[model samples]
Target: MQSALLVNGTLISDESVRQEDILIRNNRIISTGNNLSGQPGETNIIDAGRKYIIPGGIDPHVHFALPTPEGCSCDDFHSGSLAAMAGGTTFIMDFVTPAPGQNLIEALSLRRQEAESCLLPYRLHVGLTWYDHTITSQMQQCVNEEGITSFKVYLAYKGSIGIEYHELEKVMHAAASLNAIVLVHCEEGDLILKKQREFVAAGKTSPLYHALSRPPETEASAVKKVIDLCRKTGCRTYIVHTSAAKSLQYIRAAKAEGLPLYCETCPQYLLLDESVYRKPLPASLKYVISPPIRGREDREALWVALRDGTVDVVATDHCPFNTFGQKDKGADNFTLIPNGAGGVEHRLALLYTYGVLTKKISLQQFVALTSVNAARIFGLFPDKGSLRPGSTADVVLLDPDYTSVISADNGLQQCDSDIYEGMPISGKFSVVTAESV
Candidate 1:
């Protein structure tokens, strides 16, 4: 690989930002300091004038090419990785969900084939859908041989993928034994099912009712359950795509008690409110995700969590479905709507525009939430989330003054509709480099 020298830019990290030059060689950062030098004509030299160079983002929660009943999510690894690179995310950690009767290793292999078209280096978080005696041995193989240190479990979607509380405890016990982290989708399945039945009985089956079916309390209740289980099992736990204020309070309390609890909220929950669900049918259906987009109070509370350290990272769930062919399949029933939104291509710019520009968080906090925190929590660490010497040369050059109107028309994903259409954004990724791994 060709080496390069990046000069005259501000280097931003989780802790600080400083004007520095960077030398990249053999897919790793060889040096970073003031007035970095390189042999003329031997190394490529690029000037990042008036731009901020930060670690390429690491999205810890994504479902690229996720299979659904009707078909697959709109973005496969090919298009998904393209979108991620455009948004300055160079590495992704996607889930490996086992189909019914499939082993964890088989699921991992299948997902690897699905992600073979990926343009960036990626990792897997094996989702433990069902538990068997053989699962314990499989979990060990995944951690030791596959180098997968995280596992995902859902508390909703009961029959399809969700596991019971006892099963969750068993999974945590195995993960703890291997010192692996467990990521949970915390929404009480029974509560959601009960609400769904009530809503259907009341003749309220529109997209708006999707949010009503899975209330904030459902997520908060499940979050408490998982935390308590993790506490008892001594397993490190991460709550994924947390979207409720009450859940944040529980996570904060758990952390205060010295629990190794970490949680992440998506940009959708931070920027869009449940009010989107009240929009026109086609429009609202785009935001019909699990533990759906919450109200303004929850959005505000999520931002506060990021500011106050109650939340550790910001990730885009990045599961996209087209309105015409994909999401519209559920027009008659909200429950059938594919639950996801397109954000991998817009995460960094949106966060910079909304969080950093509005002064809700500092630039340092922005780096922490977007890159470092996820890296540390998910075990990517100094290699993927930092620009330090010896780290992977995954860097993004952002133009703080770049102006653009966000739209799916210009986005790189395979998804059809743009949820953030016409929203004005200030910063843009001018240059992105994802070195080969």
Candidate 2:
């Protein structure tokens, strides 16, 4: 049996942090306590002095190898997982997007095959791209047989992948029936399309116009609509990449009403602002993600939500494309740019520096946002998000004193440019251990 012992580290969980030693056998944590011992010759003893040992992060939102009209996203499963591992994430959840009229199960199987190259343990949230009588049964089959408990739906792609309110309601009902959670990309489709047309017609076809087209109201309206549907259908709903301050009031109210609503915001929405879009041609293009990075008020509001428990998780909607080849395609028209940027490799470090060091959030809250809460919401808790005995041995040893500047060249992601380029980060991952089950 493979064995190892991590000694003299501060172990942190969502609940507490304490100095402890963790013993591991094979892929499981054997025990954790003070002075845990193992055979000297047979076991690997790691000296984790002055390091903070936390559960490996679980990013519930990422889009590796996502196919768009321009091309597939730059990082496929293997490359994306490598970036994730380097950033201290051990388990990641990606989506299984089905083609029109394709079988959901078949799509999931193919996605699984593609994900086989991933270096980290992973899960998939099946996308509900269309509605049909067969979809309910398909969702049930996915949950019962495939172990997929979460479904995703888009509200902004309009005619292509975006579903109408009626369709969303039907999906919410189906998810409620199966006790599965629905992750919604909250943007008003019609408003976005109308604004895009207006911007293009007015000759304002720049990256900044991308943010103008999908304003805060567009997101906030969708959030309110989804919360209403959740209340009506009693479906557990999660809003992904929430980027607006106005949207938070709806989320906060829904959560206060005891509706099964969870809100997730990405690091970009928290750290970056709409000002990045004002930078220059391609430099600004990299930040043109859907629900485009908002203004300073929105960023500060998201940080408040993160600290106040209004935000449930922080994930990177980490779909990346080359700035030259892909994003530049939309230079003449902002609508054509692939709507994403790379952050899977930077989520933990960014959160540690900005959230923890800045006192915006505590270390325990950091653990919760980065790993624990996502696992619990997505049903991977205790095993994937915990350092308890018998839990999967996915742990990260983070050195608090180490600091570094982030750039695409040094990052493991396959993307050519980074949105977080030149951002200084404190705390580095000294050791990452992921034991396979």
Per-residue error for 130 in candidate 1, Å, reads: 1.8
Candidate 1 clash pair list: none
Clashes of each: 0, 0
Tens-digit per-residue lDDT, 1-437, candidate 1 = 37788889899998888999999887789999987887676677888889999999989888898988968888889889988888888888899989876889889988999889999899889998887678878999999989889999999998888889998898899999999999999999988988888988898988999999998999999999999997999999999999999999999999999998998999889988888888987878788888798999999999999999999999998888999988999888888888888899889999999999999999999999999998888788889899999998888898898889987787788877888888998888744442322
Task: Highest lDDT: give the candidate number.
Answer: 2
Off by over 4 Å in 1: 431-437
Error of 1 at 413 (Å): 1.2
Q: Over the stretch 1-437, how does candidate 2's per-residue lDDT look in tens digits?
A: 38888888899999998999999887789999987888767677888889999999999999999989999999999999988988999989999999887889999999999999999888899998877779889999999999889999999988888889998898899999999999999999999999999999999999999999999999999999999999999999999999899999999998999999999999998898788989988789898899898899999999999988999999999999999899999999999998899899889999999999999999999999999999899888899889999999888889999999999888899988999999999988744543211
Q: Cα RMSD for candidate 1?
A: 1.8
